[model samples]
Target: MLNLTLSTSSYFILGSYVHIGSLKYLYFMLTAMLYIVIFIVNISLIVVICMNRSLHEPMYLFLCSLFVNELYGSTGLFPFLLVQILSDIHTVSAPLCFLQIFCVYTYVNIEICNLAVMSYDRYLAIYCPLQYNTLMTFNKAVIFIAVIWFYSFVKFLITLSLNIRLTFCGNVINSVICHNYLVVKLACSDTRVNNIYGLFGTVLSILVPLLPIIFSYMEIFKVCFSGCKQTRQKAVSTCTPHLASLLNFSFGCCFEIIQSRFDMTSVPRLLRIILSLYFAIIQPLLNPIMFGLQMSKIRNTCKRVFCYKMLTRHKDTM
Candidate 1:
């Protein structure tokens, strides 16, 4: 057993791996492909939204923000994860591990809050069409985006500070991803303070944005049912994408929370790896596909962007 306290720069063993001794290259290739696809899709959506003037609306702006957040979240994990997969030893430096914890959690918090903001945007568009423009102006959209990131960092910083104070006895992180809660468990000291703060932080993070999302969706549904067919169609077209993204992310978050908090040691190590990676790998890929398929404006814009790129490539070749 390695004594973590004696050396501040000790590494942590990432203890999640499946038996694939000969298939390491294959594993690396598949993982790299997924990460690359995630990057391309999210970046494409962001570019399509930003380059088109028609997509400058509040709803699209929020989508762009979500894409950016997804990119932020994915970059935090995939780069490090991809590198780790190629190496024989699965270890992360102490500083790098903590940094990953911050980046991953902050991404999650911002994601939920961004979804809440999108829900609110939908509520305003359907419930108060007249005020929607005034309420969700471009400047306000920017501010909301800023708040989503700022608030997430501020709240998580408290938990991270508490975590920094705890002294660790062990350095083995029993999962693929570096989670703050799991890191807290490695500490040798009394973790009551860390646990209390963690619980408070977790609840605060979830409830603050989650309640607003539920309320906004409730109001949106009420309006959709009572309003005209056109209104109903508009509501469905716009809100469905956000709702799908929310449900997908919510399930992933719930699974992660359950896995992290409870004892699931009997579960197969492969299953555990999948559970840990689902949110990090899946949600980022899903968001663009959901929006691209569901939102006509985005779909149309993407088509145009692709066509333009193809034309340019042909011209260059000729």
Candidate 2:
């Protein structure tokens, strides 16, 4: 029988890292580069949205929030990953592990909620264009963003509090990062409350955001089908990137959930690692690229900003 009480100073061993001899350095470099790219691109878009008066609308405000969340999510994972990749000992202190859990859970919750709110914002812009200004004022947009962040933080705080009371039988985690589900599974103490709350939390997390996304898209599709070619074009142009982002993130999350909850022993280690990292790595990188390239307004603003800087620099040199 495993111990029912865990010491405060106890640490967790991450068991998922495969020894690749000198390849670990190569992996570290690639991860560092990826993090740098994610940071630069997300920051650039955030700056573009913030500095431009034209992007002061509710839609762009939502995008700014999205970009910020990408930075938050990636920072929570990448730096820790970089450290772990180089470390011969794959151990994390309990406090740090719990902290990572909080960060990651809150990030996921905020992301889903943010996307849900953005979907609703799009619905208003397309479905009620004339009334959008009244319906989703700048103040209202700020409130929505604040509420999404607050809700996610509070929700996970409760989950973390519940989890902290558990006594762990073991300290080995089977994945590359600190995961909530895997941690809960290690508890030697009774986890009925945790289990119940986790199930409830999972449902709420998914349905709360998912319902709005579905409703918003359904409404959007209705308008696209019934309305003229212009409206259809408008819907496609605005919604396509969002849809892509949402689906990509959702699929990544699904894979993560399935892998965590079920047996994946038959899956190849390399593929498992890639799929596990998909949501964290890809979404943060993809969002800025998708929105930056696909949205004409943002693309134009970026060009103008770059060109203006170059011209000013030339004048200074002369």
Candidate 3:
């Protein structure tokens, strides 16, 4: 029988009390709150997009998709982590391990495609405003969303099948959640096939999505200056948030692809934590904030959310 022993040390790879002292606990706690805030905000945005007729445009639709992606990203990583923070038994079953890693990857891949698709939507709106309606019709947007899900699911099945064939031999995982790279690293059997797939998957997830974003913005810039000054301001505000998000998201993919080679270095532990926080944690949190800041429509919708809730509460008293 596979020994399934669990421990506080085994699961919470970065423990609150681990030689780092109480600060680690505070670190994990604050980030956990960020995850919760992000989840709620994104879900709320999704509802607004669905209910508000004015938001039925291609851009808002794409924004809603991104909000959903952020929601999933936060959900996949944080709840298990929150439980680990508060509970004594912090380990996950090997099967559950597979599932957690799988979901994280699936959503992440979907988000990459969604960003690319969003960039295309922007390209159509800005690059060919007259044809934007015919170019990115609602049906095309729906099909694009479906393709994102399907593509990611296929990759998940491929990676999962290849990973399941390996032998764990022991039950210890160093990460708080089931991290895919870390898991494959622990496999006792040959994982060259899995590693190759990992490499390909990384390129698809990062570079494939990256190309259109760069190209789209390049075109956007060309056309922006050719129009009114108002167009230039709108272009900068809109593109800035998306650019920040794409860069931050790419940081994880870049790190993961090369992480195995770097773990042995004399790099300080603090730097690793900062990178993980910025790439994995803060990036998702930043998306909703970026949308709220740059997109006046989303910001107004968010404000209406609070006012709507308060009005309902007042009516209940009456």
Candidate No. with top lDDT: 2
Candidate 2 global Cα RMSD: 2.7
Compose the digit string of candidate 2's lDDT tens values, residues 5-56.
Answer: 3543378899888888889899999999999999999999999999999999
Q: Name the top TM-score candidate.
A: 2
lDDT of 1 by residue, 54-76 (tens): 88988888889889988999899
Which lDDT value does model 1 have at 158?
A: 70
- lDDT for 201 in candidate 2 is 94
True-vs-predicted CA distance for residue 183, candidate 2, Å: 0.6
Ranking by lDDT: 2, 1, 3
* Model 1 stretches with alpha carbons more than 4 Å out: 1-9, 315-318
Better of 1 and 2 by lDDT: 2
Query: For model 3, what is the error of residue 189's alpha carbon versus the real structure, in angstroms, after optimal superposition?
Result: 2.1
- Give the winner by TM-score: 1 or 2: 2
What TM-score, to 2 decimals, does candidate 1 have? Answer: 0.93
Q: Would you list the clashing residue pairs of candidate 1? A: none
lDDT of 1 at 264: 88
Candidate 2 TM-score to native: 0.97
Cα displacement (angstroms), candidate 2, residue 123, comes to: 0.8
